[model samples]
Target: MTIRLGLQIPNFSYGTGIAELFPTVIAQAREAEAAGFDSVFVMDHFYQLPMLGSPDQPMLEAYTALGALATATERVQLGTLVTGNTYRNPTLLAKSITTLDVISRGRAVLGIGTGWFELEHDQLGFEFGTFTDRFEKLDEALQIILPMLKGERPTFAGKHYRVREAMANPRFRDHIPLMIGGSGEKKTIPLAVRHFDHLNVIAGFDELAAKIDVVKARCDDLGRDPATLETSMLVTAMVDERATPDLIPSGMRQRMVVGSAESIAEQLQEKVFDAGVDGVIMNLPTSVQGYQPGQITALGAALKPLTAG
Candidate 1:
């Protein structure tokens, strides 16, 4: 259930031919596992995000890819960084993740969030609702999902969904760790405090401390222990001596780390961990260009110790 150090594969545009794409992905996953990463993630999106590239860029379906990855590696927990609730029916999402858990032999993490990508909904024929509407949907979806994961058949009726004694069979474990990704104090943090096992804080490096404080306050108000709710941050990483600060897009510079492996580790310890986050999940978008054999291994070797309990 712990994600001490994780790698997120956000892009699949390797310059190689189509057959080499998945082999490259497997190599990266194996490298992460060997180098001490406890978990691996992929972005849950139907189309490529604008920040990363054009809409038509290659993007694999999250759970299907995770199922395939389960057979290719022996360790390293697998899941999406966060699943969008609007993309699928709650009962179906529950079934899919449980199936993944069975395939992976109990190494599944349910990372979920209220849907945010408008283009996906518009193009894919999903409802593109207002912020409050999405949150309501997410809150109701969890009501159905949590009970099913615990092997209970729940009958629920809400504004967005209704389920009559829905059950998720063939589950490898009774409890799959739940992770919520976002830093919205009013909605997301409060939801995490009440329901999730982990909170993946999405914020700039400068805003991390404040976000952690808000999480603590929310826990306090609920008469809950803040320490029980684990936390992590997502950062864009560049692990090369030749990488320079100017190469980063201006809008993303504050949320990105650029340097050699050792320097990146130092920055994480000082900036991310020092702000009270439990660990980090790094996304190396540059790897799609062509990753050197040992880049992930070197970064993992330097970073894992800092995240150890």
Candidate 2:
């Protein structure tokens, strides 16, 4: 349930050929583990987002990649940063994560959110409903998924989904940690308070404090301790020693930080940790240029003190 330090591998489109793609990913995950990160995450997308690259850019299926990562790295938890709920059936998603937990000896974390990519939906043929529709679907999906993860066969018949005594077998643990990602106060935070072990905050830097306040307030309203629901911010880190503000893209400037190892740590401590978040889950979009052998190792070293217990 705790992810004080997480490394997200959101870019797979390195300059290398497809043959070298996954080996590079394995190297990053393994390096993160060696450098002291508690978790490694991949984006759950079928195509690259517009901001990152062209839609045709290389992208791996999230859970399939995570399952392979389970065998490559030991001691680091693995999962998607957030799986899009519309992409898979609830029962099937449960089975996927449970199998992951067993394979990793209980290092699986179920990170999900209401699917939002219109392009992916339109092209991939998954139903892209209204905002309210997607949230409602997620609510119902959780009703079915939580029970199956707990080793109970739940027969849920909601408007969006139906399951008859659906089960997930050979579980590594009765519970796999659940994390919901998004910034919506109305739906995302409330549902997170109701069910998830963590909330991976997706917000602009200026909005982070208010989001934390809302999370605490929501927990208070539900009579649950805010500390019981851990939180982390998703940040894109440019880890080069020569990193400068101009290097960050205008659209992503607020969500990203550009600096060396020490300076990056300082910014995170001031902007993120000092903003009162529990932890950080960061990705290096620049890494897509190609793998720098020691990039994650250096960043993870600087971040360890901030994430230390």
Candidate 3:
């Protein structure tokens, strides 16, 4: 369930047409599998992130993409980097993930979070609730989803979601790994300690040490071992000749890695792994060399040894 090393395909606009888009994605996932990555993730979004590109840019639905990737790669665990809880019903969400587990032969990891993008909700006709409201929904949704994943039909009533004897069938595994992506101490970390097996910390690199400490403290508060709750952070990797440190976006400077594969690995070792986080999920959205045939392999070769344990 640990994500020591993972690849996240967060971009779809490759300047190559739609026909070539998925093939590039498949190639990257296969490369990741061949080069020792333990997991592969795709961003769960309907529109391109503002930082990456315009909203109109191509963004494949996460589950559909992962289901296809499951057949393409034999070993890599497949899941979304983080799924928005606002988009679907809890009962259906459980079914979708378990089905993916069956497709991937028990390789599905459910990475979910309180859906935040207001635009997606507004335009897609989903409810755009307040911050507190979203968290409440997430809490209730988990109540139904957890039991269903474990093969126990759960009957529950809550403010946001309720299901009576909800069941998921044709499951390949009794327990699929649960993950939530966020770094908030009060709500997210507590939920991670209570239910999630992994917490993908969404924080700046300079803040990682503190975030890990909070995760540990929350686990201790719940009388759970911090080691049991694995943690990872997404790093936008730009492995190319043009990977200048100054070229990084102001908001993303702390979270992105620039330069050669060796340098990128060294920076991660110093900036992220040394902070006590458990894993690194590298996202090569638009790195110049990243779309090339062998770049993912190069990065994996240079970085895998550090996280092999």
Candidate 4:
């Protein structure tokens, strides 16, 4: 259930020809595993995100890529940073992750969140609902997913979903850890305290401490130990010494860490870890263009110890 240091491959625009695209991804995943990363994640999106590039830019289906990743690497965990709950049926989503757990020999992590990204929904024919509608769907969907992940057959009917004795068979383990990604103190944090094993705090570096404190307060209100809920921050990372702060988009500047790998590690330890977040999941968006031979390995080496006890 731990995410000591995770690498997220958020883009697929490697300059290489199509033939070398996946090989390049495999190289990064292997580098992360070899450098002692605990997990690897991909964004669960149907199109390239606005922050990264145009809608038509290269993007891979999250589960398909994660399934392929399961076979390519042996040690590090595989998952989406957070699967959009509105993309698929709850029962089916449960089956998909359970199948991945079986394939990866129990390395699956069920990271999920309320669906966002309006364009994907509008273009893909999925319903584009209000934010509250999406969160309601997520809440009811988890009622089905959580029990099935634990090998139970759940039968329930809710406002947004209905399941009749839904089951996921051939599970690799009795439980597949559940992770929720968000920073909303009212909805997201309380939901995490109720159901999730991990919380991937999606907030700016300056706001991370406040979010962590909210998580702690939510746990306290529920009469639960704050330490029981693992916490991590999703940070935009720059590992190359040549990378300057100007390369970061102005809107994303507050969320990014730039410098040499060692200095980036120092910033994360001081800001994220010291703020009470248990770990970090970093996305090096620039690497989609190209990465040096040992760049990811070097970054992983510098950051893994920060998450270790």
Candidate 2 per-residue lDDT, tens place, 148-187, comes to 9999999988899999999999899998999999879888
What's the true lDDT of residue 176 in model 2? Answer: 93
Ranking of candidates on TM-score, top first: 2, 1, 3, 4
Local accuracy by lDDT, each model: 0.91, 0.91, 0.90, 0.89
Could you tell me every candidate's TM-score relative to the true structure? 0.98, 0.98, 0.97, 0.97
Look at candidate 1 and tell me the lDDT of residue 107: 89
What C-alpha RMSD separates each model from the true structure?
A: 1.1, 1.0, 1.3, 1.2
Q: What digit string (tens of lDDT, one per residue) describes model 4 on residues 148-199?
A: 9889999999998998999999899998988999999889999999998999
User: Model 1 over residues 102-140: C-alpha lDDT tens digits?
Assistant: 999998899999989999999999997999999999999
- Lowest-scoring 10 consecutive residues by lDDT in candidate 4? 284-293
Q: Rank the candidate models, highest lDDT first.
A: 1, 2, 3, 4
Name the Cα RMSD for model 4: 1.2
Deviation from native of the Cα of residue 123 in model 3, angstroms: 0.6
